[model samples]
Target: MKSHYKFLGTFLGLLVFNSFTLASFSAWIDPYNVINSRTLPKFNQLKPQSNDDARRFKAINVTRIKPKTIVLGTSRADIGIDPEHPVLSAHAPAYNLSIPAGDMYEAMRYFQHALVNQPDLKQVVLGIDLVAFEHREDVGKLDPEQAARLETTSYVQHLPSLVFSTDTLTSSFSTLTANLKGEPVREYYLSNGRLIRFNPPEMPIEAVFGLHLKSAYFESWYKDFQLSQQQMDAFRTIVETCEQQGIDLKVFISPAHVTQWEALRTSGLWSTFEDWKREVVNITPVWDFSGYNSITTEPLTEEMHNYLESSHYVKEVGDLVLNRVFRHELRTVPNDFGTRITTANVDAHLAKIRADRSKWVRRNADVVQLVEQWSRE
Candidate 1:
């Protein structure tokens, strides 16, 4: 009996030791595999991380990346400007520090985090949205914990090399795991020194029916959303800090479609919010494209007119807005002026396309077809 008891104890100890060894090996191997491997499998269980992750990691890696000008907003600004494009390259080093569905509160938090790591930050291009000013509850989704972690910790001082390395490892792990699991990773992954991803497809009017069905099935959760006043106060604190640090701040209200603008206007709350935005910062160069009502009136080419709502403009329109903001020469103008003028230009461009819609469709038929296929999938 004594001999048997000794053998059982020894076996159990060996089992526990082996388990710890395997867990440790996994921790090291996963990161190593991601950093070394060029191609990783796309897995459905993991949501694919974006190339933006890598770009951001690289930007942080720059030995002296105290960019004088940084762009801030949601995905609209993020996807609009191509970092490698010659126009942006010629300008002061700019980082598109934008995230999907980001709002003013989140932007402010991001600014705070960025400045903490980069003490020499001098200039900022802030993208404002009227909707962001309105009461919202979904703001909690902005990952405040991570932002707070960055705020409290002197990330640069402790792990100078670890800052870039941690970012790289995290991004690679997230992406590789996501690819292994078939998931809707945000479009835009690096391929052959360029970003590539499936484009949104053109949908027939019949597609609207499908959308309606989906909407009906999912209960609307908009009512539960409410913006916290405390968070707004936090943003104000960030602005104050920037001002104290002598950073030049340029605020921009990115363009949106007219239909969307009208919806906001009707919401009774939007007007009050607009007033709030004006009070906080200089309201010039508002990149409001929401006034372009023609695209909603009639569809142009499937490729050009593929957006389901005013919120999602085609890539062409996105580029046009970027070109005007970054490259166009203009006199010293107010924030609202940029939006008004750019809206007119966008309208004109759309009107010209509508004049010969068939010709435009033919010219972009291949792209349109690709878009259509993507939508179906």
Candidate 2:
């Protein structure tokens, strides 16, 4: 009787253990369906390999990013600045860390993460836009599970166990296979020719015009050009934190389609933006490209084509913006000085800038013009 009771107890113990093990595994595996099984409509009918492969590869690459300056913004800024370009070499080693559809909130979170984990980080370039402050459905929706997996703690604590996991390896293989079958690749491609693919989505003029009018014009014009005190407080918090951390912060507005800008100006959003700009970073060079339409006498239609379609020139545009900031000698120690751009490094950077004058001017003509104009002032 005693022996039989012990056997029964052991059997039940094994059953409970197995159940708990399976349940824990299920939690991990279920989320993988979101990435691997194409459960979402946009991803549906895509092979399991597509989602898993890209993310796994991204995770590996992200582990390698030890940047001195991180460029944060939406897809427009991401595509505009190439980190590997020679122009950026004069600055600290830059990482084009912008994510697609990224906004100010997301940018703030990214900066927070970088500050906590990357001690070597020295500077940040935040591309600000009216659209960044506009309320959006997808703004704060970060995946908790993905966030956990990507956190600095995961890299330090469980990397070995994670690397050895059979499930992880299986998922990675599934992802690679989907990628090989031409599941839409993201930033980089390896097997095909080492060509950088430029696939900008077609932007409808009506949609652009409507967004401009709604966010830039209607919100600022009719609703009031006022940000709630809470929002202003948050912005101040970010600025203060950067100052405390000794990070060099550069804030600038990105260019938009001329028609969009005209609508925004007429709608009175431009005035609000200018007002907000004066308050945000008074001393820093604010490169407002919104006035490009007035500066260039080119036909509005032709200018729109040049602005919208010119990916190659977008790099030049980025250079132009940064150059304006540099030439104005807007370089100053933050009042709440935590980190200073090293003097030796700045002198070395200035030397490089002098050596690369033609390259800098061509790459950043918009910036160069502003600097020349400012020098005269």
Candidate 3:
């Protein structure tokens, strides 16, 4: 009986010791950066893999940075918008609060989250995407659990996972291994919350565009895409809050490659797309950049780097956006790139885009054919 009792005591001690060791390792490595307690150069500083729970890290980032200006939107803004643009930086310190495939609710909620942390917020640059407003009944809604997590993510709230989760321990070990290998960070977010990808994607742009059309457009997002009044209301809340707070707010339709617009038209939702713009202008005037333009018509090639794919533009185009919106010193904006649209001018603006679309279709029938073929597939 004494020997059996001694064995039980030793087993309990070993189990506790193992748990403590793992917790300490995960906390120190801080793989997801939720803890951020212990980080070192060549060991854990460059977090090569994260964003699995982006809502948590991003919320913590906003809390810690307390930026005075913020950029908000979907992945279009996430991968495109530069928080450090000369115009933005001159105005105030900015952080990109956009999320990948972000919905209007997250945009509104995160705006509130930023305001909670930085009451002195001075300016806002918001990118409103057409797809994010979709009802998603034909596809599916955002995960309810993930949506809940976005609401309460902070350092304290993340402590348990930061310490004891087996998944976190695995991530910590992977991070350590990657650091020791001295691999350059392929993709990660900057301190200002801007996303960075060190290398251009190796896949050819045409192939990538096809993947987007077939995988993303066909399989999701564009299927029976219908707008939600509830989401539009949430967007209204963000706009109203900014107005009440006296923040200088600039809203724009994020530019996509011409092929993207073609896909939207082919999906049989062109009228709905136009109506979305009208709805936005009703809420607040917006800078329209989604039509066919010099920037959007750039030839699709891996070497161009103007667009990462059909939807996500790069910093050069983003710079043009800042220039157009803020009237920056360089003034590098193309002649037909962006237009200010209010309720009065929206009808005419939509008409002009339709004319432009007709011209583009006649000129680039091959592109139109590709969109039509892919939509049927």
lDDT per residue for candidate 3 within 123-152, as digits (tens), equals 999999988787744232446754554455
Best by lDDT: 3
Q: Which residues of candidate 3, in runs, are more than 4 Å off?
A: 1-24, 34-42, 90-93, 137-154, 182-186, 197-202
**lDDT by residue for model 2 over 82-181, one digit each (tens)?**
5654445554556666655545666666666666557767777766666556554554566784465456533335344444456655654554455456
Model 2 regions lying over 4 Å from their true place: 1-63, 90-92, 135-143, 146-231, 266-268, 282-285, 293-306, 309-313, 327-377
Model 2: colliding residue pairs: 49-174, 49-175, 53-175, 246-339, 320-364, 320-367
Put down candidate 1 lDDT per residue, 73-192, tens digits, no spaces. Answer: 665556554444444454455556665555666677667666765777776656565545435655545455344444443325423233234453564466456656655544653321
Q: Rate the local accuracy (lDDT) of all candidates.
A: 0.46, 0.47, 0.82
Instruction: Report each candidate's C-alpha RMSD, comma-separated, in the order given.
Output: 9.7, 12.5, 3.3
Measured against the true structure, the TM-scores of the candidates, in listed sequence, are 0.54, 0.52, 0.87
Error of 1 at 241 (Å): 4.5
Candidate 3 — what's its lDDT? Answer: 0.82
Best by TM-score: 3
Identify the superior model by lDDT, candidate 2 or candidate 3. Answer: 3
